[model samples]
Target: MEYSTKETSEKYSNITSLWRANSSSSSVIDAETSPVHVGPQNSLKENDKIEKLFGQPEGVDFKQYSGYVTVDPIAGRALFYYFVESPQDSASKPLVLWLNGGPGCSSLGGGAFGELGPFRVNKDGTLHSNQFSWISEANIIFLESPAGVGFSYTNTSSDYNFSGDSTTARDSYTFLVNWLERFPEYKASDFYLTGESYAGHYVPQLAQLILVHNNHPKKTIISTINLKGLAIGNAYVDFESNMKGTTEYYWSHALISDELYNKIISTCNFSTPSSASKKCNAYLDQIDEEIGNIFLYNIYAPLCNNRSLSSTSISEVDPCLPSYIQSYFNVPEVQKAMHANVTNLPYPWESCNSTLNLSWKDRPLTVLPLLHQLMKSGLRIWLYSGDMDVVVPVTDTRYAIKKLKLPVKTAWHPWYLQGEVGGYVEEYENLTLLTIRGAGHFVPTYQPNRALAFFSHFLSGKLLPKE
Candidate 1:
């Protein structure tokens, strides 16, 4: 019997659920007790306004907007989005579309609130300004893509039951078309697709769609979306390399025993796991025992043991912060302020949609071909990895990129920011591979200041400064 990708993922979902399913509270406050108003339903363009924020965040200069763009009216499927203008320049900055990957995660929650967004969620379910928000250099848009993820949803229940890569990419492309129509002022904006994790698939696929539409605008009912480039961090580009690299990463880092590592590495290839010998599965099981209860995403980063606020590191955002994010989005006032969960969602918001089971039907194992096409078309392509991320470690990314066999344009060198070495960089014909030193899976959250410097330079077309 052939199992679907969703079925395959289901088998492993529980193992990966620790970080994702931190806390999902149905903490919606009684709206009757606390008035949360979004004024009238007859607002202007969906993309041009924010209903309101729960409370004003101090020192925040950029305007904020959040709402939904209807992708298919007949299906009643809409995508939720949060837009923030550049803090200083409203009119001149390029627009960046940011995505986060679970294959089914909320970009608004992860990217906008957790990583490089202007605001961070406080434990008290309040908002605070992130000094290093990516909006400093560009107009940023965070999308909760494909109905059933975050606030994006469909009236047709089957929409949630059936969704894949093609559905996702097609819907995202449609969302952009409708969004551009609503926010026409940004029609000619220099747009770039940015994301991390599975968005390695999302960015390239969406970029490909936009590129095709730009060439045949008349075919698309909407005008051309000016897609210029793409940047993805710790991206999932190749399946075999990622799986192989992650196992090796654990062994090399002393998380697994030498005997077990040797046995598994020699016997097991994830590419054909079903055909594995009995010894391979036996060793793999032993490897899992060695990896028990540790934070696999960032090998060096400490986990929040004791679950206390005091255990948090002041330098990086708290590991328990995703719980804060989930709780904040649960607040009735906050949801109303952002015009989210308007129909009163039956379930609380989560960082990753466990409710979704895309099974890999729409997923492409490798987006390398798309990346190659984009690079040849002269689009600036960047693949950055946080060196500390074991989940999608830099080793796998390096291996994946090396397969391109593109001649290097610049030798690998240290890139500096704030008078210190920030990371390392190597440039190819049209592609740049960068590594954020000491950063984890979520690079922006772990290294905010350095991440800002990295992104600001990328957006400005400045090469990473060799120090």
Candidate 2:
């Protein structure tokens, strides 16, 4: 679910509880704290710190992998990603980078747990198998982006609250370059960048930057970005589309009054300025502000409401579910696998570091600016929504996509998973629009089968499955 500035701050305040649950007790830290690490002028130093911080493991565990991936040029942060690795190497197998957008979120949480990660944590704290794991079709990499997220930490206390799309895009680009140096083989594999929520901004911005670099006269031409395409579930792009989607969905679901709907529509046409006016913007703003407290919560209630034994109970108190998952990652065995000492860090695996909270910033309405840059360059892009997501709202995504004005290839139609009508899909010259049925903001964790099928088709460069 999309977090308001207030709720976002509150969420940040309580994130440490899960950290203690996951990390070694010695590493427990307050969310608002930061550490100043000195020296270490090279990647080797960074690597050594990682080893010293987490320690060695007992036996080979399936949930861990060892590697030093960089988020910047000079400094490298450590990462341990979990997925079912392919038995044999094939260049044809695609490598996908998954992102979860919070200006401060860990991809390991959203991309790994919410979307394509291979396992789900049960209510009993045991791992459960995921039938629709995306790794079955592609090699998925989850990064704790920016810095100071998940296992990715930075020395510069200055980097601590730094945020905005430009810095994130640049840092992600740096990661790809340095990560390629660390694991040289996968550089040219068919690559796709996918994420949800704020990733609507993060994915496109990063993809555009990657496309620019690839088109340059560089020796390593990233052949076939397979970039083939990108898709987001319950995306937040256009302000109007998102807000309207919320009200309309509420109306259709009988969550609001037709009289109130008419009042909203007749009063607020958020599409154009000449149409929107200062008065309209004010009214719309008022509606949007109140949404999070009332209707929006109801729409997203099912996500947290499912206290069923069949699903993973990350926790009801922490709005950030990944904190609980971080506790799971703090195991003695997991720490050893990553070569961490466990004694150095003040906390266990953190879904978020309060020090990083200063880095989080609320996104402005600039998707159209980015989308226009993408379309003008002839890149394939897709912006989608989850019908039930009151947070980002389908209306906002629709409004955002409309701004591109690309030539239409296919009109709106249902995109299905298995035999069911999972969501709707639309096609433009170099873009696709999809909507997931019954999904909230975190689509994959809420609806894994549909999410995987969507990515399967995207990575394969084919038309979506028939409903």
Candidate 3:
């Protein structure tokens, strides 16, 4: 199902509890009574630092820290984070904050372990180095944001019901403010916001909030955040454009028949997607039927038949990798090492929080306006897509960018990596549009080397290689 449609339907469905049967009562953290704040910032950092993970590989050179930053002390809400400093010259490297979008996904689980952080989980629950890890270019922070995701939690049960875009952005901003206090060394570092999928909303919204905070006349809060730019992959930005693009992409890719495509185009009012006619809903169902059970994220990729270590490989994309990550994080020793699940959450840690995904309260129809505002503020903005991702397909991104109508600064052309065409790039007035060849919904997971290549250029403010 399309991301937006699936979310809307799930929103109205019954809310089933994913918590464990023996779950304990909610635990409240009193801000004043919490010992974490009683000590100096250095001591707090020391408490959060990971001397080593449960199954961490030997000879690992970089430092890793994971802990909670209380975003709402009154509500006892805190966001969980996993931080990895660069392997070499971390002092010189910029800081990159990576988020994953299930609207309620764990950035640590998805972006950190599953995609671009320094390590990947083996099926047997051991850690191996990710050769193309983005940590080579910057200190990466994977945040499980807006309480109720991953290990992030809220004591007030109603907070989950009220979680929305505005609250998330505010809390994430609060996280940065507090996180910087703990790691003041990186406060002056060039900071870039990055994420995939629903983070299309998270990244830009948080950036916009930061820009606004920086411009505040009174300047009551901590010093300004050194936010330099942002980049999103397989983003969900504009609803109408996304719907139109999805239909077109399916037809052009021969996933749907021409007759069905024509009917969908003529009958469905994409602008008012909630009011889809019975015929349109039936047509959409037919599309789902035709697509069958193949992974919609990457239509061409194979599905995980069994969650077995024997079938997994370090150099290849393992469809069952999520299962491995789930298993690894659920281990009691792993939680102790990472300083996660401090309250012993009733539910096991999950990559994506279904409750948050369905109950996301304030998604705007489009974040294009925020992008325009960011561009005007002189921030670097890049929207990229993985050609293989049918969920938030390249066509959808192209259509959304077209709505911005920015004059082209550089004509569209192929970008190269290691003497081969990596993908395509187009530079507009204040933004860049890019595609990663042979990648899917999670670009870094599907095409790590190419993702790293472009990510290096993005951090350095260099153009993608044209040769």
Candidate 4:
């Protein structure tokens, strides 16, 4: 349910006031306090450089860097990032900032290690090269945002209570500004924002902030981000669309009975789910029971059979990868190598922080308006979904896009990859919507080749093969 009401707005203001008042004393250099023009410096960049990860495979050619970028010095807040340069022609590749959204997930664990980064962690905690890593197409930075996620943290313990969409966007924007200072060579490189799941909120919000900064009257080059576009996979864009699409999808896919579907439709209000009647809640509970123990992220994919072992196939999805990632990052040696956990956070590293997720204060009913603003600014926007995912199903995304009321530039058609149908695509005037046929919520994990195909197309600004 969305917390967009006047009461919620007042709560948000109170929280923000408290945060600012508490943080007013600290003297830290962040995006807000940094100089307007930043120059390339070899020192800080060199310090953050990962000479090698603990279990990284040998013969690695690309440079990797991981460290914390302070966003709020007053709160001692910082965000951790893992950056991998393209193995070849690193200087020429565009910089892609990837975020993974749980509102509280670790992008380092989800994006960098589990999905599109250069390496995948093994059951034994060793790293192996991912043949279809997106690093081949762009310099990727996987950020663990909002201070409470992954190794990112704030000195002020109470800051966790105030975490929400606005703070995340602001901190992330600050991260980019400070990160650019640390790696100024990429100041002129084209930048793109990419994320999946809840980053539906993160990617667009951050992009909007960058655009605002770029247009500021007294903005300097350093403060002016070179944001070009963004793409989100299986994104949670609108609550109403998502709710309707989910129930409809479950019914259409035969995951629920016709009677239950009708009950939900008639009893529940998608737009105001927080006010759902007890009968509606009971019906929702029944629907969940009917769906059973299957993995909702990918209904057809098997549950983690061997949580102790990691799959080595590039073409196959590993359901247990998250467990393996958790194991790998918690290793003291790994943390030392990546320059993470410097403050020795009391909690063990988790892929998604349930506490923080539960504490999320303000989520809009829809981000379609922010997206429209970005499109008006002429940024390339693409929304792709994995047909197998029930969490943010293809149907829901389609419903959300329909709400935009955009003029269709291209009708739906099958797009091919390697002589096979990869998925279908439809081009609107300012946005593109596509799907990965057999992939799940984490598209890259389930269909790496197809994901890479579309990612490369996006970076190159080329149309998908219509064969």
Off by over 4 Å in 2: 1-68, 72-84, 87-90, 218-228, 247-252, 258-323, 339-343, 347-364, 376-378
lDDT of 2 at 420: 79
* TM-score against truth, every candidate: 0.88, 0.74, 0.91, 0.91
Candidate with best lDDT? 4
> What's the candidate order when arranged by decreasing lDDT?
4, 3, 1, 2
Report RMSD for candidate 3.
6.6
Q: Candidate 1: which pairs clash?
A: 6-359, 165-362
Q: Candidate 3 lDDT, tens digit per residue, 1-467? A: 11221132222111111110121121111112111221135677889999999988889999999999887787889889999999999999999999888688788888899889988888789988888999999999999987988899999999988787777888888888889889989989999999987788888888877776777666664668899999999887777677788778888888889888898889888766545678877776677656556566777877665543343455588777777788888899999999999998999887777767667666677788778878898888888888987777899899999999999999999999999999999999999999999998888888999999989988777789899
Candidate 3 TM-score, C-alpha based: 0.91
Instruction: Write model 1 residue lDDT over 212-268, tens digit each, in one string.
Output: 767762453456777788999998777656767766777778888888778767877
lDDT of 2 by residue, 1-467 (tens): 23322244224211111111111111111111111122222454234232221322233223333344545434434343332343235445777777776556667655665456765544334454455667777767777666665666655556654555566666676666655544456767767777877677677777776766666554343332445456666665555455566666666766556766777778765443334556545544444343344424226543332452344442221233443465556667655645543335565565555545444543444466666666667555666566666556676677667666677788878866667798888888777887778766676666667777777777665668665
The predictions' CA RMSDs to the true structure, in order, are 8.4, 9.3, 6.6, 6.9
